[model samples]
Target: MRLNQYIAHHTKYSRREADKLIESGRVNIEKTKATLQSVLQEGASVFIDGKRIVPKEQFTCIVYHKQKGELVSKSDERGRRVIYDSLESRFKHFVYVGRLDFASEGLLILTDSTPVAKALMESHLERTYLIKIDGEVTKEMINAMEEGLVSEDARVGGHSKSEIVAMEFAAFAYYEILKNDKKYSKLKVSITEGKNRELRRFFGVFGREVLDLRRIAYGFVNLNALPCGKKRYFTKEEYKSLHTFLKEHSTKESKKIESRH
Candidate 1:
């Protein structure tokens, strides 16, 4: 783990705070000042403000059912309500996994463990969503979903301010067309990658506007029975499954590092 990540996972300090501490020379590894690029090795002595940071044996994870009109952010410049406003004060410091966009809603994963959050978000775990769109579901759209798409001008449905103009969409893991008509369509779709505005952009290629989007699941986590705006801790079985996934993920990452060396 990097120094900032180490501080974030082992202590209450966030990654940004850890960076600041390191920059200010308050963080030391083996009595030597640590830099942002410093990588932590097992049994290495790490200290901040003259005290050792002992890694916590356990971490907390939770799922929040985000509702439409809520931004997945800590704050908004335009004064719109953010997820933090709906979350309890105790969870104020927890980091959200992936975003749910302002108009989208449903299950959102959050955790106090930075490593866990980073791992899950970067993983190619399946994300399933329920989406409603304008116009009928066409054969071309189905072909794109099945064969994947590469758009050089994918800015159509993306945020106007987004700099991304090109995007590569992976083939959807699964999709079911629940409804179809000249005026509207609805579907359940699953994809592995979580590119920015991916689903919207894909539909934009077919000139269909996404009317509603709600993420129902990510990997093994689901939003079952979780009311909008409500939050809950992971069940024991969920925790067990998560730990298993994390262990496997960590092993794979370590192997990649070893291979690179």
Candidate 2:
């Protein structure tokens, strides 16, 4: 793999950030300063800013019920509130699998296995949200959303400007009109792609403002009764189940290495 990608998979940094680190001489490959275009061979050693790098043996996953106002990042220069502050001291290094915007609260997955995090984030894992919009929902609006609409503000790959890609509505998702509440409506939304401000943008297409948005579930994992701003370690069975699921879906490189005859 490319050295920057390898660093990203093994460390807390993103791939783009890893490139910057390499360019700045903060990363070393086999005790030598790494270049931005370095290619890493199997079994090659790596280090970041003099810290020895080692792949995780046993992976750990956790579900965190994030609360509003908590930033979903490892560090912030602006001194903003962050979710890492709420994690146990021993789990301070775990990477978040996906992010929930600071204003939005919901179930977030954290894991020690970078490969697993990469897989879950890059594969467009399904996420379900319970959203409250500040406007009445009409049948026409619901049908239009179900049929998918394009947003003029959507951008692809940071360069190509186009309409927002329409996501398929899950079967159980629908809008609920509240009694005596003429201005607000609640909806259960399920989406596969985790784009920036996706649910809000989806509703924006219909001219409805999102008053509140909370993720209810991710994959087979659900927040259930977990309260906001709290976290729980994954049960042994839950951990095993995730590993088994990953193993089943893993590609050749991610599987156990086998010897050739």
Candidate 3:
């Protein structure tokens, strides 16, 4: 693994923070100061500021209702608000699975297990969202998205496929509605892929502007009854379900890597 990734996996700091530490000469490999470009071979001992680094003992997963204006990163160079500030102090080395933009807020999964984070974030795991758009959605646009439309911007690397899990049209005064006027319409859209600003861009193609976006679910996890800007610990069963999924996926990936070797 890369030096920064190794340090991030072993420390409470995020990957970006780990890179900063390496650049500042705070990280060491085998008692020698190391840089971000350094590589960590298998079974190599690492240290941070003279303290031996160790793997986390217990893993924790949390469901946080991220509020708008809070950056999802662990540390922002610009001194912006971050999600870590609201996390419980008892957690030693937790990292977020995915990110929500500063203007967006909803369910975000945080975990101490790097492997679990990697599996959920880097894989094809599905995520669901409820979005409020600025105008009435046309049936043609809905059909096009369901049939997998080719995005003109191509911000998402792979082909885009969106299925409207549920659709509801109501007055513009819902609590979740960020915009309310006689000219605008509200929609709750759900998609599997969690691409960057995907919901907004998807609606943008149809000339609709997304006023507000909120994630409601991720895989088997849901944000039911969880108020905005608060967090709750995952139940034992929820943890077990995630753990098993991660273990199975990791094992398959490891075998694939071995075969390539």
Candidate 4:
């Protein structure tokens, strides 16, 4: 494991924070100051703030962009294109953190840790999307989104209540109109929940047609500089940020749930 990952996995500090501590000369391996590229090898002693950082299970994380129409299944029944086809054969055991429907595209996380995925999904980890929809995206529409929407289909999700069952309405952390050509406009929306085809249905409430949709960010990890159909291992900083976000979100969620009762 890398030094930063080691600190993050075994300690509450995130990978980015570990990097700062290391650069500030607070971390040491065998009494030598550690660098970002420093590796934690067997029988090596690592100390941060005069305390030892015990090594934990080394985890591997990958961020991949799912190309549209590339099915997310392990294997297609009829042999259609799938996301795994683009990944290295060695990563066959890894499971995707979340599902992106066949028609949807953008940042996807592949990892062997089920606990990590569960923690994130149960929390309010934010997902950001860049979507291009037909027709003008007006201020009124944005205001409606922020207030939330009641989907026509309750089986999927909505906020309406009548017979004692109430569903969550899709809400946004922020919405930005990136481009507006009148006929077609590009938008950036950040959402906290992963409702099934929520964006499509959310826009449908306004009678808009979604042309293109892509996830640009998840939590603190950004899908930058990576092309479609390619995968890369998480750097120490990214790994740390992922863990930090999960921990903070999990704590906040548990508190919210407890307060409700």
Taken over the whole model, the C-alpha lDDT of each candidate is 0.91, 0.73, 0.71, 0.77
Ranking by lDDT: 1, 4, 2, 3
- Tell me which of candidates 1 and 2 scores higher on TM-score: 1
lDDT of 4 at 258: 52
Which runs in model 1 stand beyond 4 Å of their true positions? 1-50
Listed per model in order, the count of residue pairs whose N, CA or C atoms clash below 3 Å is 0, 0, 0, 1
Tens digits of lDDT, candidate 1, 1-261: 667767876887877899999999999998888987677788898999899998787999999999999999989999999999999999999999989888999999999887788899999999999999999999988999999999898987899899999999889999999999999999999999899989999999889899999999999999998999999999998999999998888779767856987
What would the per-residue lDDT of candidate 4 be over residues 1-261, giving only the tens digit for each residue?
Answer: 457656766776776798999999899998888887676787898999888876555667899989999987799998998888998889887778777877778999887765465566655678999999999987767777789766444432222332423234666888888888778999999998987667766776677877888998888778897898888888899989877786676567557745976
Per-residue error for 75 in candidate 2, Å, reads 2.0
Q: Would you list the clashing residue pairs of candidate 1?
A: none
- TM-score list, all predictions: 0.86, 0.67, 0.66, 0.68
Of the two candidates 1 and 3, the one with more favorable lDDT, higher being better, is 1
Residue 176's lDDT within candidate 1 is 99
lDDT per residue, candidate 2, 8-83, as tens digits? 6676777789888888888888877899657687898898888877865577788999999899998789999899
* CA lDDT, candidate 4, residue 186: 92
As for model 4, its CA RMSD to the true structure in angstroms is: 11.3
Model 4 bad stretches (over 4 Å) = 1-56, 154-168, 249-261
lDDT of 1: 0.91
